[model samples]
Target: MAGTFGNCGALSFFLTGYLQRNPNASAAEVVRYLDAKCQGQPDQSKRQHPQIRARYALNGPLRL
Candidate 1:
């Protein structure tokens, strides 16, 4: 998985679990949750950086 997806694998795995738990989550909410999980509490010792760094350009909340 790491060889194929690199750091994105971790992000995808986490996001998958999050979506499974919050099936009604919106796009904005998903981004916020990912940001908080990946960036807000980073592991400095491992040199971890956020995989998600941009926001979507949608006119309204995009539900997923």
Candidate 2:
């Protein structure tokens, strides 16, 4: 069995499909879109990994 982030390639597949659908969107745009999509959830609907990825993608690679 797979864990939350290791689910049978579904996450990667979904992300690829989503990016394909929004071909013109930038990485920041994708992050914002994902944030907006989760806006109705509790705790302001924020995600940890995506935010970290956005930081690296938009700002640059991490130091460590």
Candidate 3:
């Protein structure tokens, strides 16, 4: 798990869960929500970079 975060963080995992629960929500919305929820959170682990996080969130499954 640590290794995974070191590579890409838990952004994708969280986004996946969020989408599962809120299937109707847009990726952009999830990103905004995550940005707000994760703001000020420590990233010394260098896993949850803003760009990568957004990319993962935006690239997640869409609700067609």
- How many clashes does each candidate structure show, in the order listed? 0, 0, 0
lDDT of 3 by residue, 1-64 (tens): 1114434445556667788999999878997877764664444453435665665543332222
Off by over 4 Å in 2: 1-14, 42-64
lDDT of candidate 2 over 1-64, digit per residue (tens): 1012444232344456679999988988876665554444322222235544455442421121
Q: How close is candidate 1 to the true structure, as a TM-score?
A: 0.50
The lDDT values for all models are 0.54, 0.45, 0.56
Ten contiguous residues with the weakest lDDT in model 3? 1-10
TM-scores of the candidates are 0.50, 0.37, 0.46
Give residue 59's lDDT in candidate 2 (0 to 100).
40
Q: Candidate 3, which segments miss by more than 4 Å at Cα? A: 1-8, 43-64
lDDT per residue as tens, model 1, 1-64: 1111454544576688899999999999998887776553334332323333223222322222
Best by TM-score: 1
Residue 44's lDDT in candidate 2 = 22
